[model samples]
Target: MQGEATGGTQTLADLQHWTWVLGRAQQMLLENGIHTMEAAPLSGWSDPSAFARASADFWTDTMKLWQRFLDPDSEGGAGEGEPAEHARDKRFRAPQWRQEPLFDFIRQSYFLIADHILKGVDALPGIDPRQKEQIRFATKSFVDAMSPSNFAATNPLVIERIMETRGENLLKGLQNMLSDMSKGQLTQTDANAFTLGENIAATPGKVVHRTPLYELIHYAPTTPTVAKTPLIIFPPWINRYYILDLSPEKSFVKWAVDQGLSVFVVSWKSADATMGGIGWDDYVEKGQIDAIDTVRNLLKVDSVSVIGYCVAGTALAATLAVLAARGEAAKVASATFFTAQVDFAHSGDLSLFVDDEQLAMIESLNTDGYLDGRFMAATFNLLRGRDLIWSYVTNNYLLGEEYAPFDLLHWNADVTNLPGQWHVDYLRDLYRDNLLVRPGAMRIAGVPIDLSSVKTPAYVQAGREDHIAPPESVWKMTHHLSGPLRFVLAGSGHIAGVVNPPDAQKYQFWTNPGETGSLEAFKVGAKETKGSWWPDWRAWIAAYSGEDVKANGARVPGRGNRKTYGDAPGSYVRQR
Candidate 1:
């Protein structure tokens, strides 16, 4: 099964081959009573009266569906009546579904059964909570897989395309699937449509310094006069740093440079066996601290503004706390955190996967010293299963269609490995222990971290719909910071909320002047503002940036003791 589907040579027959393989696997599971035991909670007719009532209701619905199917004047089989809101979930959005009654009936019936099965499982006598969660997750996956959208035979869009192209599209889709399999993954984007330095991370800059852990990039100043205080950005090492430098129009790095602030970004290396021993302390010392020192030295500034995104922001906060203890806090002018959480108490769904059992399982599987990037990618996809998983599956497998190239999706697929030590420590100390928010709970570079001691003026932003770092979790940062803090809630989920460029002006943001309270209270007091939050952030950071100096255009790639290591979006970003 591994090598059966060769790239470019896959025919429509390959689809049938995979289907047969799946059917055989299902048969094996059924014959072994896997389904019966897994669904034991729902298998028995424990109460005869309730069972009889359910049977009658099922029969009634089936009769109505049959009547609708036979009625010529019926609105093209629109199910007996409109489906409940859950049945009409966006993932099932196919024109034929609502336009054709049979498909609608099939979808509604599937959801109805799914709801009942889940209810029965929840009511089961004395299941372990962890086991119940695992069971429910598995059940949801099974139900989602059985969706009509996941099968060509049941999907009207796929049927129409097959009839139109005489099955060429099917063959193409098979080749696409085979090609992706050969690469040891599924095709999430049109990879051929993108080249790293050529387009995606095309922002102009130079790598000023390089280390085994990261490369420090100095973006060419877009404005003539730059701020006296340079701005250094630390993006999460989980993915490549290019998300901040995606395209010129949407690039946060570019936006800052245009605002007359000298910008430097840290592009982290993809971890491997060689980097398996790297820990959180190494990230702070060699990764963030080293970059900050280099930027300060180059600009000859006593203090610099810093920005951290996601996990990087958490690392930055810890670093600042360490610096403050050492009386070196003067190096920071102000701190800006984007979708970063210092408190893990409200860290959302991601926390569910970090318990002892799951961590132990992950550790056992990651014997090679690093967590595979694909595993991380899959976990995140599960958080938004309908949009990221099922939708792509339906388009590629069921509809036999090629994915159109999308920049953000491409970036999402370009995942990087995580060092085992760093990953384990992060999960245990932060997610499991909630240490960052606790005074003296964590130590970095020989100094204990207390976020409250770090009194740098702060601006914190969180996405209202962020699942990975819930806004409430981010909101807690205000209480921990000793300095004046301003918190803003942006629209959309994690990535989309932050990547929103000003010109695009797509999402709205909320702000409450001088507001300080719990997240719910803040929400009640905040007023909505139209357009990107970038402008608001720009205005806030400007006051701390100091007056702009005359454009020197002096700092190019190979200046001072720091020689240019390479071009912007350098070698580290190009690493697999």
Candidate 2:
């Protein structure tokens, strides 16, 4: 019944729509630079005979497909039930099943014929590149002009599931698919864009120790109690170090010290061959484990609280696991992970790049043993191609617009390369195989990773909109730990989520460990606290800070008269 109504084009509007559809053949050719200018009108469209022939071929095939449902003489009559099922099944056929190769051959042949016609057009005169750019932009605007809502409704690919159905399931699937795709695109756009503070004052404070993976910097309190417990902060090596204590107004470390906690953060060194051979195990051992020993000896503290951010959290998890398995777990007081993951099974979209074939391709490149950071940045960029790739192409080429200068974009564009070996091992072991979550699945320097033995009180944070490590993937760390655990869910992606400062516009969260039945249940009743999660974390540490003893927390010999680096925004940071 429905098929007959659609087949019979009774209204003028229907005929006009079909006419516009046929016109798309010419428009698509124009987008490819054919017939775009008087000097270079599409060569293919140059010959009236050839253009008419191709137009007939395209329209004929399209009508053939359409007539299966719409043309009264071709299919069902007015009283017949819809042929929706057949159409849907046909549309859903895989690319190969759709004879895509043959379609490609036909498309190429049309292009060849079009080129012959365009040659005649090109002989007329040359067009300025600037004008050509405007033409390109105008052509692209046809596709880009649709508002988000209109695109959702009119996009044929999106509306197809509902097009052939009469039941509730059709609406449900359409709604869900639209919602999912919309969120996916939005997340992709957000991930690739961020704002940066301009003319950021660069001054240095504290001395730093450099390792192959990073440089450890410490800003000790000016007036320290005779003895102060040192807090070592391990930031993810993915970006520059200052994010934690960005400035006096928003400095997380400075806030902690005001609460009387000594602080040290690892300023991850930019990549070079000397760092290329470094892998997860190496980072855990030399990067983290050694740092612990150094801080422990330097400060003479029996134990200290350790905080890890993102990838650094993964490193901390492994380090603690190795320590626990070796029966040497007393050096750490507590552990905190900000959006870190121990299990990769639920990693959401990041999993797209982690399958066997991709890993093999990466292995082929990592044969030199270090994954270049540039390669890692490129892979991440591809994941958000609509914004990161197309937006730039549109602005720089199609629109001929000057690249807008922004600090965050500068930082993003200033991508650093990851060592080949580091990435290969990380992807293969953690993401591809989910090794970290497997019982005794991971080993470092002959030590098996048994996270269940890690009794350090733990705090784990996951971001709600995070694409790199979704909440589901990150929260798994709570399940693996043996100690009382706190899991926090923040609002933004990897960086913004963590850097989230407390404001009415934002909120931070927490609840007592095991105060509720499960992570899900606890989240339901968790208290919402305003402002940066950083301050709350500082308070949490103070509560757990061992009683202030008669002696200072920990004392290092080189503490006083130590040379302070230039100031906030040091020399190396400026170099970037």
Candidate 3:
């Protein structure tokens, strides 16, 4: 019955509702007998030897701690109290955690038990590695959910706030949760604080071209004279393209225009049931290729510099390979990739959730032809649970505090759905099979994609702390590209690293003079440079850009053979 419902067109809310219902049914079945059979080895406390070993270790550690506490004259006693080795852990940094010995004792005891339980589970006999991994991930999720820090009753900071507020905060927190639930979503940031065109994607531009797959945006030039070679940006369709054109001050699109470059951005349509048939080929042909053609037609230039971020970079690389095969490689003067992974072997923690079992489950949920954006958002939030999940939980629930409007978090919440076929194709071909880097393994637009054939001088930027596309994975593109490659390692995580503006001057970047085959060798030879990687990118991209020419005045809305669809952001970005 549930499967039948999933097969039809369902809204995110409907899908989530059915998911809950099915999940509960599964839980009930598991609780009866299936869990017992499957998790028999995981129930290690039932084993006498395992229980005894854990108990013995626990007692030994407790007794030693007790002895240390009692003996004033001991080597590290009252006169020289030893600090906890884990004191630096930010999670336990609350004043009450240290001021009250009881809290510390409780915390330490919890860790002790958790450690033993994990060890016992790990030592379980005859369990498959994949099953063991699933068990471990589930255990960690359970442990984290039950953490004292997550609950107002157990958290010291929450208790202090409660005492100060005289319980008013708790009521407010309940109200906030109820409000968010009413909207059928989780609250990450104060959504009410942001308006799309007015604040976020406010850069002046016009939607000069539109297709079923995307809207081609030509941003108004900021300089009297612009570079002859136009710059076309292909952003990941999984999220709104506004991330690059965020706010005027931090807008890469605006900055590029200011630098005397004609900037064109492709805004991908949020997928729906109508777009179910849209596959990887459609994205390349009707999406990137179409946008490139629009830019070329509008600017009347044969060659254009290109920029791609995250998944878009992967698609763009394939598009270039196809173009190169067709003898149209000169259409792209140079290419820039921001935190994009061409080689999936080192794709980081995101890979853990992409196994056969998980993919099958995902396929079931995507039976309606599109994966819900909210579902994708939840998966990403899990990647950094401490920052994206529990922190928000504590702020909105325990403290009853509303989130301050943050631009990046706001953009993150503004997600777009993926066509079912495209999503599965990406997971199967690139991630599961690791085929993108392999020549003749995959074909796009009827041409065999070979990354080695893509010899356009490339600029690749990877965030050192990026958990999604790890720097090592992004660096692998250097080995595949036959052209001159410059790889820069930026400080901070994925989004922040790419969005770093020169005026903000927050994160630094590392650069090596030349590309090396080995990622480790590149890192060793790289030198640290202060400030945003944007400047370095601009300089490199400009090198490939042709000489400055009189700026072609901004195209009038709905002018020429290709009429403007709407405003800069277009109708697609406002879908959700």
Q: What stretches of model 2 exceed 4 Å from their correct place?
A: 1-204, 222-227, 245-250, 367-369, 386-410, 503-519, 547-576
Q: Write the per-residue lDDT of candidate 2 for residues 1-576, one digit (tens) a residue.
A: 433232322354554454454347454664444344445463334444544455565556445434432454655432134235422432223332123222222222233333333442343234454333434333333333321212322223223323454334345534544643564321112222332222322212444455556656665454445224567888777766666665444456656655666667776666655665777777888889888887776666777789998788988988998888877788888888988988887776566667678888887876555555556666666555545554443333222233454434445544455667787788888877888877778778778887888888887888877778888788778778888776777767776787665533465555544565455776788776655576667666765567553323233223433444534333444322
Residue 418 displacement (Å), model 2: 1.8
lDDT of 2 at 248: 48
TM-score of 3: 0.86
Clashing pairs in 1: 77-101, 224-551
lDDT of 3: 0.78
Residue range 1-576, candidate 3, lDDT tens digits: 322221223244543443344334323433433345545544333444544465567557555544443453677542134346456656677766655444444455445545655675676555677567667766666666656678775576777777779888899999888987796567888888888889989888788887888888887777788888988999999999999988788888888878888888888999998888888899888888877877787767888899999999999899889999999999899999989988998787777788888889888888789999988898888877867888778889889886898887889988899998888888888888999989999988888889999999999999999988998899888878788888899999889999988999897998889646787888788889998988888888888898888775433234445667677787889996
Instruction: Note the clash tally of each candidate.
Output: 2, 30, 0
lDDT, candidate 1, 188-248, per-residue tens: 8888788887778887888888999999888887676888888889999999898987767
Least accurate 10 contiguous residues by lDDT in model 1: 1-10
Ranking by TM-score: 3, 1, 2
Using TM-score as the measure, name the better of candidate 1 and candidate 2: 1
Clashing residue pairs in candidate 3 are: none
